[model samples]
Target: MIGSRVKYRHLHTFVEVARLKSVVKAADSLNISQPAVTKTIRELEELLGVALFERDGRGIRITRPGDVFLRHAAASLTALRQGVDSVSQELLDNVPPVRIGALPTVSTRIMPRAMTLFLEERTASRIKIVTGENAVLLEQLRVGELDLVVGRLAAPEKMAGFSFEHLYSEQVLFTVRAGHPLLGGGSVFAGLAAYPVLMPTRGSIIRPVVEQFLIANGVAALPTQVETVSDAFGRAFVRQSDAIWIISSGVVAGDIAAGMLASLPIDTSETKGPVGLTLRTDAPPSLPLSILIQTIRQAAGEVLPV
Candidate 1:
């Protein structure tokens, strides 16, 4: 029986081979020789007293034992990497700051209120907020630069390393300056076609859905007065022109309340969508991060107002 003298490098090498399914490929990835990779796999199998890989005429295949071992290997690697990151953060006096990335809409609205509540409770911790489009934010979350994100979940399916917690739904609303011809007495959709519309940039998640809805309803080729992604610009453009601006209700609540903009009377039943929180699927969130997520969830519920 091999005693408690096993090293992590041997297990890591085995995992690399199992993942790549070829000694040459794994060796190249690890910057080691194919023979060295083969030896490590053999050594790992011997230590475990099980065949990790079955090599046939076609190629190598992972056995049942190999699958089980690979699961543990991957988990162990993740834990080791996390430990290293924790230690590095400590050495740098980083204090395990919770980095949050959010969509600009949320960044300006619910995020600030939630963060205020979070900071009140966690006075000792550090918090960082980054704002961008959903795609950019998700990419940051995947790369570990963000502990969590509060934004629309992107995709055909959720990415492997992330989990989403649905916070609330944002209803799309079209607004125009007060007393504008298309205001239609504070209706959401009324008079939408009387004036050219200003929309978010074409690549925004809501753009396609909004366009499709308009086209399906026989409102195709609605004149687009302009397109801009900047929230400030959107609000300013609406304030200065009769151009309509579509925005998430949660994002423009303050402007609506202040009487700077009025929602047109159009039925937005077709434009509602999920707005939620995303975090790494496999990692246990840090204590501070957990608290922040809850606070954001609560704030989102309140700010969206059904």
Candidate 2:
């Protein structure tokens, strides 16, 4: 059992070191000496009655207990920060801000419209938007750092502690520049392997489906591949090169509608996935959060392609 003697500083230091995998880097990030960082970790380990990390050569590996503790420690720190922010807002602005996490797909297509409509109605409201992969966003939502997350459904294991509300369904598509050579090719997949490809990052929920689709199509490996989830990079790269981009249909909906990009004619129904809202089961929504959720539903109805 962990003792109450552990300090927040200890947990903070431990999390930093675990994240960086180097005590010196953690020390520099925290603006403290390396020895002080080590002493804090030691104290926390003693209090918990478990070794948190193991030093091997020049790097450190978090022990099993450390991995478990890191989750709780990070959650605690996030909760504390939220509490401070809430109190500060209540004291000064008399209104608490709503924090939201959105995956790139929704951020690019739906959020801009939703945010505009929401702000138009509630002009004084404050909303903070964070963009990241599903796992990172869900973790933040779980820990109360975010009021909710809007994105594709995560794998079953990652959805363990949260509740999801289905918003809509989305499919992955293979897209290219408007006038790419593949446009009139008799064998699209055959010629695809000759050009560079852009794939979703590993953390994306649709990445595995994208890989499976490629395998099913008999393209064993792309000649060249770039993995990313940045909409700006994707837009620029595809417009400037012959690289094929496999991504959520919603992300490039505007580009497709505007004829800036073209979706391949290949059927991709097998890659369909649910996009939704993820929330902590234990927490009730604040007024601002509740309002935003309604606005999102409305905006999705308006913006998401049929």
Judged by TM-score, which candidate is best? 2
Please give, for residues 61-110, the per-residue lDDT of candidate 1 as tens digits.
Answer: 89999999889888888999999999977865757678988877788788
Alpha-carbon TM-score of each model against the true structure: 0.64, 0.68
CA-lDDT, candidates in order:
0.79, 0.89
**Best by lDDT, which number?**
2
Model 1 alpha-carbon miss at residue 11, Å: 51
Native RMSD of candidate 1 (Å)? 19.3
